[model samples]
Target chain A: DAGITQSPRHKVTETGTPVTLRCHQTENHRYMYWYRQDPGHGLRLIHYSYGVKDTDKGEVSDGYSVSRSKTEDFLLTLESATSSQTSVYFCAISAVSGSYEQYFGPGTRLTVT
Target chain B: DQQVKQNSPSLSVQEGRISILNCDYTNSMFDYFLWYKKYPAEGPTFLISISSIKDKNEDGRFTVFLNKSAKHLSLHIVPSQPGDSAVYFCAASAGDKVIFGPGTSLSVIP
Candidate 1:
């Protein structure tokens, strides 16, 4: 129930197309993260941002990019969408960098045909 | 390689019975552990967490037991209810990075 929301809850796009998912938070937390949920694989971190304009890649950052222009918004972009990139994407916010609990947004489901 | 592992894919418990979910980690440097619950069509939510320094931490009906020597942890839910039926994911953190297990689905039969 944290003040977080993801735009385009559901979408379908063709392969090799550009796609961007947005995450917006109202809690003003300093840390924001993007994760993809897949069957049997659980959740894998794609990218994260510590502060405005500060970002870092995660365990599964391949073929994905993220940016945080403002404290309230974080964006995940796929330069060229692929079938492998189709999954439920979640955005999370945390107050601290490490050893801190995170609040998650509803999620965005994207499909690449 | 998976740093965190949940051996069981699914479990069933009768209402009012105890439900136990287990987790194991390979990293010895992990200093923090957490449990997250996810409902269908929704993102996961933090349920409870415990630091490596402690063996056990309890909050109401939920209790997390950590065995650093065995590199294992378990979450117990007493008097399980239907609302507690969901996929439970165990996570371990080493500094800024956290690894999550595949998740165990729990079905509380009424």
Candidate 2:
């Protein structure tokens, strides 16, 4: 309920194809993060942005990329999807990095065939 | 190695009873811990949190206990209700970096 939204709530795409997921926030947060949730992995960060045009990789950023051109929008892209990339992706925003609670969007369930 | 861990995958508690969920972390640098609850088809929501310097933090029916010496923390809900049934995820933070543990599914039976 922190004014966050994710597009294409549920998506199913074939492996080796390109895919992009979008996260939009109205809170004007300085930090935004993208994460993937698997059965045993919990929530693994894919990437994060401190500000517009400032992006960094996360623990599980092997085959994923992210870009932020504006403060409200952060996009995660899979150049060539794989079966292993199929997971529930969540977008989060925070006023500060770790000092406060992060607000989360609904989530995007991606299934790669 | 996982810096944060939740050993239990599931828990069942009766309505009007207490529900306790546990979490452990291996990092000593972690200075803060938090708990989040999630219902099916939705993202996790912030529940409760505690600072490393404190042993306990309470808010309403929810209480979080931290044992720094043991590198353990737990969340307790009193008089649990069916609406409290959800997956709980624990997280640890060291400044700008935060790590998450695998969640524990809690079912509050009515």
DockQ per candidate? 0.76, 0.75
> In terms of docking quality, how is candidate 2 classified?
medium
Query: How many residue-pair clashes does candidate 2 contain?
Result: 0
Q: Rate the local accuracy (lDDT) of all candidates.
A: 0.94, 0.93
Give residue A19's lDDT in candidate 1 (0 to 100): 97
The window of 10 residues in a row where model 1 chain A has the poorest summed lDDT is A95-104
The TM-score, computed over Cα atoms with residue i paired to residue i, of candidate 2 is 0.98
Predicted candidate 2 versus true structure: per-residue lDDT over B1-110, tens digit per residue: 99999999999999999999999999999999999998989998999989999999999999999999999999999989999999999999987657899999999999
Q: What's the C-alpha lDDT at position A74 in model 2? A: 99
Residue B105 of model 1 has an lDDT of 99
| Candidate 1 TM-score, true structure as reference | 0.98
lDDT of 2: 0.93
